[model samples]
Target: MKKDQLYREDYFTCPIYFMDKPEWVKKLNKASDLYIKKAQKNNQPNIKERTKKFGNKGDHGMVHHSTSLINDPKFIDLQEWILATAYNLLDEQGFDLKGYQLFLTEMWVQEFSHLGGGHHTLHTHWNGHMSGFYFLKGSERTSCPVFEDPRPGRQMNLLPEKDKSKVSLATSQIHYKVKPGRLIFFNSYMPHLYTVDNGYEPFRFIHWNIQAIPKGVLNINKE
Candidate 1:
């Protein structure tokens, strides 16, 4: 009789995709700056600030004006590229994108200036299938984003890793260091946050949410 060695299989793994677009980074940065200045002059509120980190209040959540920005010529090309990349990702993940009508539910920009300290608390996006971020500007001093394990209960009993790989480790959270022009996409249910800023400069990024509706589900043509 021959002895058989058992192999471990990974299941229910989290998926994340990253891409780089230098051209879009430049355009987004310029557009973001313009909008930020305009919003400040107009006394627009920053609705996306949840942590209340120290900084110029107007600098955060400036992208809530996504509707207008999307229409702006400065952002149209970048928006189209983001959509195309997202569709490619979905197709690679075995999703038949042709079967559904995809819609962009929300698109926004977040800027965290390290006046003292700035960070976002762990949270998940709602009312969307996917959430993503495109880094318009980043620095080595800026802390990376982290994702928490969705299964908190499973983490109660941890086992030592036989392999030294970070992905194979039984860790509750993982962090990713990103640079300018980097784009990341992940599931909406994944809880994630930006680590505390240790850098002096502002860390800026564009965030967006996507939703897919099956074709003809609403049946509006019959009316």
Candidate 2:
């Protein structure tokens, strides 16, 4: 007699979206260069002291973070597309968004130091429903983003993986290799961070977060 086969179902799965827009790379990078310069200039005094203490190190241990890019005219087109896509993404995930409107809560550009040692600690954006990165400059030699498994139970009761190199149910972390014009989107609650940069290549990217606000809670309309 033949035996019955067991069934399996996957639940609470995580989704990550990405796009490659090579055409927009040059324009956005040009626009953001001004902001990066201003950022480093604004912090020139501190940078000078750091350089003195660090002995002429070529920006190997600092990150230049730009001011809000939400109001910038240069990035308006990209913003509109990203916001609309984020709404559709939520809808595709079966979220009931009829009573809510998605809003761009935050957006900024940041560049890691050139000689290396640039990184961010693992963390999540609790204030937003969606978050993303648009890499203006990066490569295999530069730092990349890494995401951790969000399930507390899975994290607490971990077992050895038969093969850690493969993406299986036992995997607990993920790493993303980035390049210019590469965009990635994921749930805001997922903890993610950048690894140490060896400084072999330039590293720069724009990061943003979007939140869904109920219609009742929003007073003014978005322009």
Candidate 3:
């Protein structure tokens, strides 16, 4: 009885989900090409320098952002899938979503500059309840997502790890090996960032955030 009472139970754990959907890559990538082109302003034939990056690096180290994909017909199927998954995930996690509807609050595609040095700093999507990524292009030679441990208290008095390669509770972060059509979902509060890309290979992904709004909170169709 004493031993049973002393057993440990997991709580406040973070969850991350990923799966491959190769069939969606080709069409989605084709649909997103125009958006990326417009973002980089490369469609103008007369413009020698397309876009500008910070440090006057000539677009070498910057990332291009696309407008919302919410109203795009090409991304409709993906939107449906994401909405269903988010709804199920929250329900499974013990959230009471009875009086709420999941909304695709934000959706967009972004690509790193081809001239190299593209990267993003650590950040969280606090505005939404859940967020995810769907890779349209990537490989071993390209940059990938890095997620940090969500619990800040654990980092305050961390101990040295025996081996950095092996993941243990002491591990502060995890690097996700990315590939085309690989979709990843995580809590909105999770801190994540992308590693710097040398531009040896193309890296592009669709990122979106979902918010659960109470019934009748907003006059919009629920996903």
lDDT of each: 0.70, 0.91, 0.89
| lDDT digits (tens) for residues 1-223 of candidate 2 | 3579777899999998998987999999999999899877766777788778877665667888999999799999999999999999999999999999998999999998876888999999997899999999999999999999999888999998999899999999999989998999999999998999988988999999999999977755542
Q: How many angstroms is residue 162 displaced in model 2 relative to the true structure, after the best TM-score fit?
A: 1.8
Whose lDDT is higher: candidate 2's or candidate 3's? 2
Candidate 3 lDDT at 60 equals 73
Best by lDDT: 2
What's the true lDDT of residue 63 in model 1?
27
Tell me, by TM-score, which candidate is best: 2
Residues 1-223 of candidate 1: C-alpha lDDT, one tens digit per residue: 3469667777777788887777677767887886655544453434334335554443343222332455567767767776777777777777887867666777766666445355878999887777798887786777578998877677677666665346654766778887898888997888998887865666778888777777777466556
lDDT score for residue 43 of model 1 = 36
TM-score per candidate, chains pooled: 0.78, 0.93, 0.89
Clashing pairs in 3: none
Candidate 2 least-lDDT 10 residues: 214-223
Better of 2 and 3 by TM-score: 2
How many angstroms is residue 93 displaced in model 2 relative to the true structure, after the best TM-score fit?
Answer: 0.3
